[model samples]
Target chain A: MKKLWNIFKAGLVTDNPLLILMIGLCSALAVTSTVSNGIGMGLAMTFVLLFSEIFVSTFRKAIPSSVRMPIFLIIIGGFTTIVDLVLKAYFPELSKSMGVFIPLIVVNCIIMGRVEAFSYKQKLVDSIFDALGMGLGYTWVLVGMSAFREVLGNGTFLGVQVMPQSYQPILFFILPPGGFLIFGLFIAFNIWMKNRMALKAEAAAAKENA
Target chain B: MKGNARLGLILAVFAAIGCGTLAVVQGITAPAIAMQSEKALNESLKKLFPEAASFEDITETLKSTSKTVSFEKAYLVKSAAAPLGVAVKAVGSSYGGAAKLLVGVGLTRNIAGVTVLELADTAGLGQNAMNDAYYVNKAEKITFPGQFKGKYLTDAFEVKKDVVAITAATISSKALTEIVKTAADAAAAWLENQAAPVATPADQAAAAASGAPAQAGAAPTGGK
Candidate 1:
């Protein structure tokens, strides 16, 4: 249970994929038109990332280091194709809305990054845990950013009216520009928080030395 | 030295295999991808007119169908449906990129259907205009070739008098109405030259011809 908790904690913060590491941002901008879409993409991406990490870890030694990138790409692309076809066949409208992003997962940096950086070195079980942590981290950022965008842009949550009618939505928040604006603010906010934490740590150490 | 050369040879061979693998995958998926596109275009057309059993490319590039000496000639999309036979498309810059819609007509130019093939409007607002709401439910019955449909080339109503444009989308509206009008004029020119009869819209008659479902696309082709 402690291990599981650590996995969740690692993903949700400390190592949040998008905010801390800046990974998988293409679909972050593309599918974030709505909260539901954000959720859909997050879950689908998490699944692909998790399974591919597992597969890669199991065959890590068998794969020559030189050809690892190509092998990882094929794995990611094949999984993304499956997800794309399933969405197209089952949820046609959502499939249309997701559009080019589904195929684009083939190039998403995070999937390839995790496969190479973590799965390549880790044992299979360790790789699975790392994958779960990273996938959750990715999902939380999508949901969080989508939450910020939807509420401010449309004055709603998941499409339901959240803010009262009196609240005038900053309609631009949901547009393409909004994606960049929110991302920039979060980057600043994270830097500020990190600096504050470091300052407190230094003051505590200084007083102890004194 | 031998180790380095061996390594380089292995890398070259691996790179060749990678490219070959990509080629094979592309070859397999290309046909399926093309088929999906064909299905989507056909589906969009069918949604406009249930009677449209089939559609031919006719001319693929839309720029070739232009008339009225305003925009370049653009291509034509012909639909063979009766009673409410008509073509529809909006033209102009819809907020962002070039905006144009083209639809087909049959008898009475009473607005058979509308197609929004190109758009670059604000995603949630004007882009919403292209969704099933604006295109399918609200604006399905609008006739195209705004002026040529009802009025002859000898006398065309000003766009303000004849067209119904979506509010807040004036540029797109003007572009769309012009494309419709151009398609009408071009089709009329071609048809009259061939001595084939062409039917244009009669708004008052359609208003009286109620009892039919609310005309989805018959809103005047100009802006509010």
Candidate 2:
């Protein structure tokens, strides 16, 4: 259980796809303009990541290293298409808003990196927890970035007018530049938090030695 | 050689499974996707003509008469008692890509309403053209599409002249105006052609040769 928790924690903080590893930043920036879009994209990515990890882990031994890349792509691409079709059929509004980004998920580095690095060697149960952790880690950061962008950029949260009507929205917060600015701040904050925790851990170890 | 062949076989098997799975999923969602788009179109048409009880597609009829401007889709909007007007969907090239618009033209040659169906333009600039919340006239609370209501089909459709342009988005504004003009002109020509069916072939040829249909000159009777 502790090991599972550690794997999950790694995804959320120590090895966050966005903050630490810094893979799959394109969609994260592009879709973080709205809170709803962020949540929708994050969940959709989670679905694809979770499934791909499961398939890769379950068939790890059977998949020869020589042809594993193609096999991984097939699984990832198939899952992405499924997500796209399902969103179009059921959540047409979300499907429209996200546009080509959903199909672009097949190429997201986070999924590919996790599947290759962790799931390919890990057991089934461990892969499951890792997938969930990584998925939620990606989700929380997206939601955080989108919340800041949407609230400031559009003067709205999840499409509702939360800011006072008198408050003039700064258009800069919603643009591509704004996405980069917020992403930088998030990385900085994550680094600071990690540093603080490391210092505290070192101090505790020294105290135990004394 | 044997190892390579075995690897290829495994890859092919995975590819086959992936394709089969996608085919199944696509088969399941295809119908629902079609229905959703149709539903969306109907809803937009209803929004344009609020009192419209039903819509009959007149794309073929309109296509025959509308030689100057082409429309993607044309519909005869109708109420319970009588035909209200014609609605046409037209596309114009914007800065980024195609901007699709739907314009409803009343029988009195006045624009009933205008709606944007699809737009692939630059975000924050060109996209503000269709955003209702981004008002062109804050005091009047008038949206970009809102200005088109009750406008005469003969009015100048030039951006920054008769049409108000979005801030720093002249291309988007011009594209939308062009699409609206095309839809309105197509609707007008078709409506005129339908209204005056007794004209001789010579007169029809003259009208077509002129490249502009003669105005019906009928006074506005407030089409209910």
Candidate 3:
């Protein structure tokens, strides 16, 4: 149980796909304009991540080293297509709004990174935990960025008017530059938090030694 | 040699699995996707011409007459005995890739409105062309699709000079304007051809005589 907790914790904070590792920043920044968009994108990516990890770990032995990358791509591509088709069928509005980004998930490095770095060496259960933690971690940050942007840029949350009447929305928050500006701040915060935690840990270890 | 052969076999197996999964999912969803697109096109056409009671596909009319610019499809919009005008689906090259639009040309040979169907331009700049809500309070500057309403083809659709280009997205704005111009020209040419075939010879002669100024006025190069 403790071992499984460690695997999950590593993905959530120590090795987050977006904040710490920065594996899939390109696709991540594209859909952070609204909390709904963030949730949709994050969930879609998580679905792909979870399934790809499972497939990669299951076939780790059968997939020869020379052909592993191609195999990973195949698995990821298949899952992404399924998600794309499902979205188009059931959530046509979202599918339309998201455009080509849904299919582009096949190329997201976060999924490939997990398959190679963690899933390839780990068992299926541990890989599932890692995928969940990383996926949720990425999701919460995306949601945060989106909530900030949507409220400030559009003066709404999930299309509902939330801001006071006199407050003018800043158009810049929902634009591309806004995405980069917010992403940079989130990265800085993550780094600062990590540094503070590391210092605290070091001081505790020294006190124990003394 | 044996190891290489095994790798090949494994890769083939993986490819087969991927293909099989895609085929199954596509088979289940293809019909739904088609229906959704059809519904969306109908909805967009309706929105573009709110007054039109119905629309008839006249893409064939444009294809048979115009050769310089081609549209994806053209629709003849109508309400009872009145001709609402024609709407054409045109594509233009944006900074990203293609910006697709449904352009409505009214009976008076002026632009009625433009609705962006698909835009894949940069998120902030080119996308401003489609973000009409962004221009609601900031109407002092550029207004998209709204600024296009009621402008005649004689305007020649020049960016910045006639239509205020979206800030930082001149390429995208230019592309969209060109697309509108192309649709307008094709529509005007088709309307001219439709009017020409029905005129009697005496009327044709009279049209040639007095229509000279009208022809000059409606010329595709009127304002370039």
RMSD of each: 10.2, 6.5, 6.3
- After superposition, the stretches of candidate 2 with alpha carbons farther than 4 Å from their true spots are B1-5, B58-72, B80-82, B93-98, B120-125, B192-224
lDDT tens digits by residue: candidate 3, A163-185 = 99798878788887888899888
User: Residue by residue across A1-210, what tens digits does model 2's lDDT show?
Assistant: 999999998889888999999999998998898899899999999999999999999999999987888899999999999999999999998898787689889999999999999999999999999999999999999999999998998789998999999988777888889999999999999999888878998999999999
Candidate 3: chain B TM-score against the reference chain B: 0.73
Rank all candidate structures by their TM-score, best first, as comma-separated numbers: 2, 3, 1
TM-score of each prediction: 0.63, 0.85, 0.82
Q: Per-residue alpha-carbon lDDT of model 1 for B42-108, expressed as tens digits?
A: 6765665566654433231222233221222222334474232333343544466566565554443
DockQ of model 3, rounded to 2 decimals: 0.58
Candidate 1 chain B: minimum summed lDDT over ten consecutive residues — where? B60-69
Top TM-score: which candidate number?
Answer: 2
**Lowest-lDDT window of 10 residues in candidate 1 chain A?**
A4-13
Find the candidate with the highest DockQ and give its number: 2
Judged by whole-model lDDT over C-alpha atoms, candidate 2 comes out at 0.84
After superposition, the stretches of candidate 3 with alpha carbons farther than 4 Å from their true spots are A161-178, A195-210, B51-70, B78-83, B122-126, B136-143, B164-171, B196-224
